[model samples]
Target chain A: MARELTHGASADSVGTRPRVAAQPFLRRNVPILALIGLLVVSGVYFSLASDTFLTLGNFLNIVRQSAPALILAVSMTMVMTTRGIDLSVGSLTAMVGGVGAVLMRDGWSVWAAIVVMCAIGVVAGSVNGFFVAYQGIPAFIVTLAGFTAFRGIALILTEGFSIPMRDERFVWLGQGTIRNVPVPVVIALVFGIIGWLVFNKTPFGMRLVAVGSNPEATRRSGVNTAALLLRVYVISGLAAAVAAIVIAARLGAGSSNAGLGLELEVITGVVLGGTSLFGGIGTMTGSLLGVFLIAMIANGLILLRLDPFYVPVVQGRFSWARCGCTPMWRVSATLRRDSF
Target chain B: MVTPEEHEDGGSVPGLDTPEPDDFVLQASDLTKSFGSVAALRGATLELRAGEVLGVVGDNGAGKSTLIKTLSGVVAPDRGTIFFAGELVHFSSPRAARSLGIETVYQDLALCEHLTVARNLYLGRELTRHGLPWLDDRRMARSAEQFLERLGIVAVPGDAVVRNLSGGQRQAVAVAKAVAFSPRVLILDEPTAALGVREVEQVLDLVRRVRADGVGVILITHRMQDLFEVCDRLLIMYEGTDIARLTTKNTTLEEIVYYIDGGSGREHQRAGSITSAS
Candidate 1:
């Protein structure tokens, strides 16, 4: 009976590839190409517009300025891949900076303060994870509320003021570089590599993407979805805290506004790097490229003597265009008519 | 009713038929579950023999899915006993069920569309080399190729992302993943419901292939055509109750439907009158 069914149905043809194979290639590579094109265009424009733009000093400055944002972008990449968002990253960064500053003022060692601040960041992120993953709250809502509440806590703690660290060791970490590379850049690179390995090579990374792509299926496949979600949030929180340390060290102080609006830049970098906002598609390499693209844009605008405020507006517009156009082009270009 | 003795030899032997011993791979007795006031399952009993495809069929809301979830550890039964390999087992989580060799492939196929075929096939249990414990791409691709070839699933590049594959191919990959661990009992819920006629055949062939590998299959499907094609025995559930059990050769679809629609008396009468006339 089974053989009869097979013969009857086998006539329909078994191994024919779908009509369109070129679409996947375009879908995967187009955004990456676009990002590279944008960077090259901007780099050329800036180099022609300003004598300082192409210098090694300016390039190092760009890397230093982009390090915190890059770290946060890396964190966002992991969180968004799991179909969750961390709106509280900026606020969490500020809070960590505030705590570290307070501890430094109290005569704590620079390394000791850094350790305590990072621990606080993990705890804060874990709390966010607990509410979102364990208590079943939407990540957006939980982190959105956290965005305001944590920022308020930071502001209140600092009395709406900035506190400077006069400690030589801490100041050197912020202002000094090792072999012409800023310390923050080094830290971001190390963490970025670690993040990449964790997401790509480890079981934890596999489960993160699996849960993000299809939570129900992952659960059915026997994964603990809540645990994975919780871990992503915690990682995001730790990233934010690390960003705060970088920012504080660079400025030689912890400001209440240290990472204000940074979440937007980090998220922009992630999206610009081809990480989908709807989740389940992205790469650390893309995110790294994205951070550079956003940073270069801001730096280019400054070099052209444009108001820094316009940077955000231009970045916002670029993100909207990318978000609206890229996925549509991908869908129409790659997927077969019947597949949709 | 037919005597067990008449079909014993041709019956595929109750327990020793396969290499496994006489222990039931999975056994559920009087399993009951409810969602709020609605009873999804009530006192459903099932015994899965090694190397057999036991097909379950019923209309909508007949609790077929609930039973599969309970056995696969997706849901904790409100009442009853479950035994696996002759030891009483309570799966507090789905992971527990998997550890005990119970894997399920839901109709949605439970695949990550963004990931490649090899990645999806090895999502939970990926092959890893000694260094760094990273996803051993070469090993995974080789194993995935072998698994697909063993099942006769063709034309799929091992590195192709799942989203790029057709619906049938995705289903095939899901089934392959479930069978990757050599699960003792493979539970496939509506394995071919969404496929075209040809796709359905491919899935049924995969099901038969799994059974031939000495893994008992609990196929929860509503299609009578498929039931007759691959199932060794027929189990009819109605309103969360197991109303009839018969060998596929001895029972008819009409009788199973009658039992499904709560026509036990009419079913008995039809069987009685047919026997008398014969």
Candidate 2:
């Protein structure tokens, strides 16, 4: 079937029918398949190396630790599908958390602080969106400015200090368990499901892919491409804020130093999950696996008594190795088109 | 040679109280636009009757594209008037023109390569379930199939990604997208610019099918032979102004080529103009 598509040399036999034979499930999802294989191999290795690694408690703990990163990664998928990046997310997380912490310490209601955090997220995202969408600035440049500016604001707000939380209920959002599942895990699952639905079943999701694929074409089709791009950045920012709240609750403090270099981790996981860095292609399922893979690797490395520092090194190398395969698929697809 | 006034009267005339003689569906008169120092369209005018295929042929930079852009509302003209079914209208954007039943299939086809055929067909205008935010993919796919079948476009399935389709199939999908809306005025810009011999025939046949549906089609092309094959009348443009309009039944291919080549000299212009106006 692949050969038939690649070579128009046999046009006579195939006739004018351009009906592409449906690719088998495995063939269509090679990246996801590869990730699953890696997971199994790594799971086995970890299970043998550390008896505690395969335990249900350890698995739940991994989910809890990775919940915040997963939340950010899910939104990153949406942004990247529009061929956009949000370097500001890490810093936005810190800023939102720091501000929320300060507001709570000042005797503000938790609901009020949460609302304010979301508002800050919207404002910050709108600014980034305005420059990238309305002002025609590149997203990378706009978000890079946002990254520095937001982190600075967070540091200034918290006075470069960590403020401990006194509200047990607010902290419970992170540390509490519901029906034997950690609250953060449940939240992550909800986010994952919502992200999948929005990415696959909504017009907003389809337009993101279209805008990334061909902005001019989409604009010509009467779509407000600028607004679509703005919404994408806002979603990223909003998700970052939500993640920040979860992190703050877990830490029982709002720290200006939280989520440092977190943007790279989220981006790496999204890319590793088969969402193309170039945009126009994204998979929520793949992202889930990618985030889990990273978190598991980190946990297993610690359990194996390996230097905790090797976690980043292994992650960087593993992502490089996995993402390296992505371009090969893209190249072959390009070659097939060029053959025509 | 056929001046703008020589055709049917389409522009607004206050208190005239005279019904238009020609069944003209769309008309653009004395349209002019300039980008910085370069004038793209200078006094370009044309008329389209319902169920007629009007061929717009020109050399490179002849402003064929610019004139079409103005008519389709892609680019606002700096000066001119457009009449749609005898009502003077202004198009603020392509969406406005589309809402008024004018659909343009640009040279690039405006298809999202990563999306499936059904998805590309309903890119911006999506059908949601009970007007909710969720897409009605099943219904859209079903309707997409019906649309292709109605156009006699075979072999392309709704589920197939656009990137995998051949060039001809992609063109077919673009045309189907325009026609599915049941547009009154269908403008095709260089639809056959990038296609094999068979593919060109398929697109030309599609144009014929659209024309038979009583839609006014303005086809812009550089290929003289294609114009003769599908167009009812030819509007020849040169140096950003339409210089001649000729009926296919009355003019030879040589005559059309002469106008496209600037009619060479003043004598030729006079002769060409006289022939076209007559």
Candidate 3:
């Protein structure tokens, strides 16, 4: 024990060692690069298979159709990065759209309906956040409850009927175009860019990652982890509202069935984009690429006139194949158990 | 009430007496905490001085962790007074304590494995553009590099993900993060546990350097040898109470182990007989 106190031992062994080399660019971006390659291959296949696949009109159509899911994926990426899930998103979309359409059909101004719907989104998201962040409930469980309850509420709002929206101003939100770009596509792009900046360039984004990576560690570092998580759920809820508005205006109806099975689709795209299911890792670029890839598949399949049921089957297969083949998935799995 | 003089050499024992109040850089008296009906800490006390390394040792469930938690503001005490530099302070949160120059490196290391070393080093306290939310990643990386280099930690590249580092390297990074801000009172909880021989030596050497910078360090560990190596004084906790405070040179491993095993009842019988006879 006394010998351990020898003051002569080199304390600066760390100072004199050679610097380790940084990770190579390719190795770090393998997942992103792989997704890009897949996207290109799929593009070539679709273009060769269908005359409409490569047209600018078809490209804008695909972006328009994908706008809602893209917006949802942006928020989902943040949620999943914290090792949480908002299973209620699909149902939330229905509730917001259905309720907002009812308000507008009954003579509520379009802007007023939009404002109220956004507030609803905030309230619903806060409920989920309160339970998960403040009450210490698992996010999956809390949002699962939301999934069931919100859908029921949507059904109640519309009385199980699809109400037609007659407001031209509201209809423009979904169908209008700017310089040939669909309104939905424009909104998606704006949200996507903002999401990217918030996820990559800000202190809040960095802290969000830290919260997902190690909540206790982040808390010890003097961060308000609970507040951060609450904000994430709120964003998810708000995104669902925005998505709801787009879906309703595009369809020109407030149907209780809006965004049906949309949550799984968004999750699939996000996970395929290289975001881990267990939390702590996310890439905004990867998520966008993933959402675009899914949109391509849906559009290409329709152009080929395949059975609509085949779409999900193919998407499911793609997810498994992507997860199975990528070395990154293996890394994510190892990280959760921290076998390293 | 006899006032004890300061021991500049850190080689004198203060048996059955407390050091002068003003001599302590950090002073906590009668700290008590409870989780439900279970009392984790019952009237624990500790004193630390600048440029000194105080080792806290106790058996499992001896409340050493609870005491440290209370001091670090992770858990508020039910009853206690913590005076930092002779000013009574209340810590509502770890952030509050941190603002006053107190930093703690928990036993878990708290490094985000998926993030790069630089990101983890600046995890919560990221450097951002003035009045803007954008991260100054370039500056943070540069500063992280300098921090690691200054600590002689070259094996860990600033850009490397923490998950890929070895256990020793991870510990080194954790220490570097703690010392980066030059905290006044740094509390380390079992920093060298489960580390390799060379790694343990590196950590101890790092502790020596931190103390040389005139910071008061509180080292809590189960490793007895580590205490003798880096700790200036030993504060023994028994059943949630600090029963003995002895200079490192004046106490033997046997005495520390005895006190840790609930030997406070025999303090008078063994005190002068053990080492003060000289």
Candidate 4:
């Protein structure tokens, strides 16, 4: 190594390179901490308001209820990190789950039904990925069109009727517990860990952020930015497929309405977790926390007997508040450049 | 830590042994490009030798940028032939040119703001660990630290974020990224445009160091004084034509400026027109 160019008495302070991130831990994680606080405060109030809300059984139910969002939000964090959103995923969940339920109703083997459902998810995701990645369309616009078109397709496929399922194996995926944890929750946990390693320790993860930060620059570096963008959407679709399988099993039926408004739900959780909507910044850990936080919020709202419409209104407001406030104090780019 | 080139000799192109006695590091001839009816380049030519810094200066829309883009392979020229390392070459994309040891640092610097210095240095081409498919962050980090220290760049840590670095520091990182690969030709577009005096000097020092290792450097800028400070020769582009070429030792700022202004007295230094330095 070349000898260090000693410039001043302070050896560690060099150029704009910060000393171990001058921003304290408190500032960096303030939003996440705030969400956790919100979760606890809301959890407490609801437990006091209703006798059943505080029970261990209800808490497990909340975990089960959150399983789909938890799984999809992990991949959603990946998509948003690249500054691309996947709005079609909610409709995709309904379509895939509805198809799976239909397959079971027709007497198909559970394994075959699950495999076909996963394939459908991958293909459906590719449709959105194709236009957004290869055609250079904005993700929001492509997925918005997909959001409507996919729902319509699901409606046509199910004929607006719920297809009831009666498979024990399928039901096990949603309701079965592993060592006191719900099966879906367990699966979601595995996905979260894998998502973390992939994002933090792989070249694909680094490339994703690089593309998000500046696609032109990343392309100049010889990376295929378009292809990277495509793979990301595909991953989001695959996650949706798994979520669909679990949701269908839990409800004992598949309907076009299975994941109505779910796109907003998971997207809200992802943004709330500190993944920048503008792209290039994402965290799996933050997404996990945000997903659980939303699940708890939903449980609390139901126990309090608040109007159903307030769920989205309150969720959107909380997410907007945290995202709006956090970057001002946390992100260095926001502090130094103020371009944000 | 400086190399053996002690004096800042601007124009004395060192004679080096090669199979082709008249071989230039890079020679682009009669290049022409057009965006609609506006001809970006009419007929421009450039010649650079190993261990030399050639300054390219011109007004906006004078085709200096077009010339750089052509050589760097950012776009296919409407008409031209580029002879690099003594072989005729055609580049469909910048990556093609880069693989043949040709690299360009554009005006934006091309660094991802969120990436660490090490990752930025090896963004497109990252090394894997123990032959596995995963990126070897620790190896990249350690090597990045070593290279920066060798280049006398210690202000920024290998793990530091690129967005957090100052203008000059970011410029150093960009130059260092190109230099680490040891390319035969390195082209920089206005690296000192937004830098402070000290920062400019830091960049110039790195340029001088790279030239010491026999890499041909092309600097395109509007800063006239900077041309005199480091360029061995000045290639002046005026209205999309290569009308003047002057060895830095044999020319003045006034003469270069006159060429830049498209004066009547300008002449293209074609074959057998080399001026003798007094």
Highest-lDDT candidate: 3
Model 4 reproduced share of reference interface contacts:
0.34
Per-candidate TM-score against the hidden true structure: 0.89, 0.89, 0.89, 0.87
Model 3, residue pairs in steric clash: A14-B152, A15-B152
lDDT of each: 0.78, 0.82, 0.83, 0.80
Q: Please, what are the lDDT tens digits per residue for candidate 3 over residues B26-60?
A: 99999999999999999999988887889998888
lDDT tens digits, residue span B68-171, model 4: 98998886899989999788999876778888888788888989988998899888778777666578876676677666656664355677778777776787
**What digit string (tens of lDDT, one per residue) describes model 4 on residues A117-144?**
9998888778888898889999999989
Candidate 3: TM-score? 0.89
DockQ-best of 1 and 4: 4
- Please give the RMSD to the true structure for each candidate, in Å: 6.0, 6.9, 5.8, 5.6
Better of 2 and 3 by lDDT: 3
Model 3 lDDT tens row, A29-136? 777877888789889999999999999999999999999999999999999999899999999999999899889988998899999999999999999999999999
> Across residues B154-190, which tens digit of lDDT does each residue of candidate 1 receive?
4455677777777767777777777777688999998
Q: Which stretches of candidate 1 lie over 4 Å from their true place?
A: A1-27, A332-340, B1-22, B194-202, B265-278
Q: Residue B176 of candidate 3: its Cα lDDT?
A: 76
Q: In model 1, what is the error at residue A242, expressed in angstroms?
A: 1.2
Q: Where does model 2 exceed 4 Å of error?
A: A1-18, A331-340, B1-23, B264-278
